[model samples]
Structures are given as C-alpha cells and as structure tokens.
Target: MGLSPSKRVDAALRRAPAFAAACDDAFDRCLADAQGAFRGVRLYQLADAAARLHASLRASVPLVRRWVPSPPPRARVDAALRAAGLEGEAELSRAQLGEFAAELFREAVLAGAAGIVGVGVAARAAPAVVGRVVAVYAAGAAAALYLSLG
Candidate 1:
C-alpha cells in the first residue's frame, strides 16, 4: 500500500536533504533561462515555463505516488509569482513571465533550501545524541549488574 498523506509529507521532509541539490540546480537553471528570455516571448512560452517548473519539482520528490501531494509545488510557485506582483492574466509579457519565474525560483530555493539544511542538521545530530545516551545507559546498567554480583 502507498504511504498515507502525512507519511508522504514526512518522507519528503526526511529525504529533502538528498534531493535539495538537484532541486536548487533545476530552479537556478529555470531562473537563468527565464532571465535570458527577457523580451518578446509568446504567451504560451510563459505558461510552458510555469508548467515545466511544476513538473521539475514534482519529479524531484523521490516517491511519486501522486502527481503532487501536500505542499503543492505548482500552487506554491503560482502563489510566489502572484506575491511578486504577477496578476492572473490570460496573457503576459516576456518580462512579466521572466519576473514570475524568477520570483518562483527565488522563493522555492529560499524556503526549501533553508528547511533542508535545518532538517539535515537535526537528522544528523539526533543519531549521535541518541547513541551517546544509549551508551551511557548501557554502561550504568552494566555497573549496577557488577555491583549486585559482587
């Protein structure tokens, strides 16, 4: 059976560190490509770019039971673009689309990258701390056993 929605989120969170580098690269490329097409592009090109951005993020997540699960990447990208002053228009200028892509990439990298690093740090630290605690407890139990025997 597939993982529950919550479990899928947890899996994404847990594995984000591994996928983060590629995600960053993809977003960076998207930003750069958008910037290059800074003038005289068709409307479909802009929409295509947005769609591609969504697909890239969707593909980045390791276990893909759904096209997109919770924390919807496409919605987040659109929201980020809107926040950056992209109105919901049927047609947009090349510069506008570039700006939208740039904003989306910037927000995604900023939020997701920071989170991945924080999670990575915590995940690594937790095991070491747990190992030390386990070791100390084992040592104490062994000493107690020795005392009882004596």
Candidate 2:
C-alpha cells in the first residue's frame, strides 16, 4: 500500500536533520576553498563570494528536501529563507515557501550524496543504503544551520 502523505512527510522529516548537516559541511568546504583560491580579495570579491554561497545554499535546499522529504512548518521555511538571505518586499504565502524549502532540501540531499560518492566512499556501501545515509547526514546539517540561524 502507498504511504499516506503525512506519513511520507514524517519519514522525510526524519531524514531532514542529516541532510542539513551534510549541507553545512559542504558549505564550509566550499567557503574554505574559495578563500584559499582568492586570498586578499577586495570587498567586491567578498560580496561575490557571499552571493555564490547564497545561490549554492538556495539551490541545495530544494534537492535536500526532495531526497529526504522534510515537510517543515511553513513559518519555519519562510523564516529560514529569510535568514538565508532570500529577500523580497512582497509577502510569500506559506504553501509557496514550503514548496521552495522542500525543493531545497531535496537538492541538498542529492548534492551531498553525489559528493560522498564522488569521493569514493559510497563504493563500499549498497546504493540504497548510501543514498539514505547521505540524505540523513545532509538533512541533519541543514537543520542545524536552520536552527542556529533561524
């Protein structure tokens, strides 16, 4: 039998925390690399770095949600996006923001999984297990970042 929508969402939330953690780790690595590659950069360069980071996080958010399936509270999602630097004068509805957050989570999960596999760690594990593990880690990272910032 197919899972109920709420049940599926609940399953996804369980994975969210891990995905969040993986995402944070990925961001930390990316920032470190960027800094190393561009030492003593100007203010504009720093701004550019910040922009890239924001874009990366935004893109990853949807992936993590898709892979891990965390149906966060609408208010939480909105607050997260805002904290992550998504800005607009217009009011965003809960549904819209929720969808965005879900998508972002999925994206992050996929990216995290890919990263793990790319580094040759996934070869030792079954594909399904690897995917699930990656989802959990990424979701956790994302949740930590969200809670800390939001």
Candidate 3:
C-alpha cells in the first residue's frame, strides 16, 4: 500500500524545497560547463533551454494534479524546443539541441522522483506519481516556450 494521491502531492510539496535546490545546483553546473565549451548564441541558447527546463519542472506540481493527456514524450519535447525557438537557430545543431533537451528532461524527472523519496513518500507510488508530475512539467514547459518564443 501507498499514500493516497493527495497525500503524495503533499509529500512532494514538502520535498520540493530540497528538490528545487538540487535542480538549481545542477542547472548552474550545466550552464557553467557550457560556458567553457560553448560561446555566443550557442551558449545563450543552451542557457535558455536549461532555464526553461528548470522552470518547467519547478512549475509542474499544480498542473500534474490537473493532468491531461498529451502527445508522446519525444513529440512533446520536440514541440517544446521548437516552440522555444530552438529550431534552425544555427546556435546548436538539431542533434545537439535534442541531446541537451533529453538530458535536461531526464534530470528534471529524476529530481522529482528523488524529491518524493527524500520526503519519505511511499516508494511504491513514486513512479506513477512522479510520471504525472513530469508530464505536466513538460506541457507547461512547452506552453511557456510557445508563449515566450513561438
């Protein structure tokens, strides 16, 4: 048995502060690494993408509770990057951008799961609950990108 849905949400919320801190640290490190290895618009684009990923995960909790079905994961991520103006930007190749997007998304979702675990939420429910959280985060990220850059 596991915590109820609402209890899981509450546990996640309690865990969020720590999770958010970890996300910030990871994103900053990624940005710093990019600075040394990238420059100019490429660098800026990576940073922007990272920011969107971080912000999207941070904002996902509420939206997850209101879950709606969306396109498959690849499509969603692609749409989000495109909506965020990552396509044909010449700042980064499609492959590069795709790799970065996938990496960042994975990191975000893992962070969510870690947060749930950190808060001592029921282990059994973590995957399903975390998936819902991450799905909504992706949607919000896509929407934010579209509104801001589409």
Ranking by lDDT: 1, 3, 2
Give me the candidate number with maximum lDDT. 1
Report lDDT (CA) for all predictions.
Answer: 0.48, 0.43, 0.46
User: Which lDDT tens digits does candidate 1 get at residues 12-108?
Assistant: 4335543454434444455466685633333334444555645655566433212233333656656855776755564455445545654554445
lDDT of 3 at 137: 65
Cα-lDDT of candidate 1: 0.48
Instruction: State the TM-score for model 3.
Output: 0.28
Best by TM-score: 1
TM-score of each: 0.35, 0.25, 0.28
lDDT of 2: 0.43
Clashing pairs in 1: none
User: Where is model 3 poorest over a 10-residue stretch in terms of lDDT?
Assistant: 63-72
**How good is model 2 by TM-score?**
0.25
